[model samples]
Target: MSFDQYHEPVNELSDETRTFARMIVSLTEEAEAINWYEQRISVEKDKQAKAIMQNAQHEEFKHFGMDLEFLLRKKTVWRETLKAILFQNGDIVELGKEGEEASE
Candidate 1:
């Protein structure tokens, strides 16, 4: 679906809604990490780990989408969420530093 589909009406959200949105985003981040670990487990020959990871991935995927919707409901930008994710991990900052060092 388009990003616009996630747009939440401004008046519909209260402070609690904003707090829930932030929580969902946090959960999404954790799910992403779990999903990554599951992928790594899938690479191994352990059938049990693979199955567990597969289930976790599916749940996390759903949670991520729902959380995105929650943020949109709060009139928050998807790009802002993305930026928050990246900035929280220092990815953007590290990339910027790498770019500057490479140009020198």
Candidate 2:
């Protein structure tokens, strides 16, 4: 989807929500950059750059999905609506704190 499709006027959102919206916009831009890198690697004849770009793109996609989830959860919507939107994908669990080890 185009950025224009998701773009809303700043005045439409409260100050705190506007901050979150800016983060979403920034993340979307980063995702697009990663996508462009992936395409570039696909066309380039170099093998090493292609592998690097592929890995980078995967990481970027993960971050993008996480950011989207974070922003959606912060919105003042019904519980059912939130569940419906994010259900069947996965729960938005947080990672362990710094220096903390995984329990599993």
Candidate 3:
């Protein structure tokens, strides 16, 4: 397996950091899978194929959310920052600014 996830030497990183890297990779892969499904579903001729892709995409969404939650649990400031921005209706840029300030 390629160890491209580690910028630093893998031997130098702690176990927790390595685990975090793996999850980050997993999160990225899940996102990619979701995007691929979206594209495929959009052009699919068969309704059944589209529905199957949609179902698979939903699974990717769950995996992405789980990976994000795991990372957020490891980083308190990140969790606190996102709380101000996520699920809130407002100017997204303003909410992002508020999240940054709140995290600080």
Candidate 4:
């Protein structure tokens, strides 16, 4: 079986690179779970079920955040760009453009 997460041969990658790839995959899965829970909660008729889904979705959010933080710590450029883009009250596109420019 092949893992799509790897673009190159697995044996050629360092242990740290493999772990990063795994964390990236995990982050993607958590985001997908959050999306699924959002849809389920939206249509759920039972309040208790919806509440449970919300709780689960919150966990996904935390997982996503931690995964992102881990990746950011490993990537200075990415962390720098996001530092400019996140938690700022400006035009998002403009901020992104600026972030990209500033990184360069």
| Index of the highest-lDDT prediction | 3
lDDT by residue (3-101, candidate 3, tens digit) is 989999888899999999999999999999999999999999999999999999999999999999999999999999999999999999999999999
Worst 10 residues of 4 by lDDT: 95-104
Q: Rank the candidates by TM-score, best first.
A: 3, 4, 2, 1
| Cα lDDT computed for each candidate against the true fold | 0.63, 0.64, 0.95, 0.95
Off by over 4 Å in 4: none
Candidates' RMSD to native: 10.5, 10.2, 0.9, 0.9
Candidate 3 matches the true fold with a TM-score of: 0.97
**1 or 4, greater by TM-score:** 4
Per-candidate clashes, comma-separated: 2, 0, 0, 0
Query: Pairing residues by index, what is the TM-score of model 4?
Result: 0.96
lDDT tens digits by residue: candidate 2, 23-74: 7786778789777987887798888887888888888888787776677667
Candidate 1 clashes: the total is: 2
Q: Which stretches of candidate 2 lie over 4 Å from their true place?
A: 1-13, 76-104
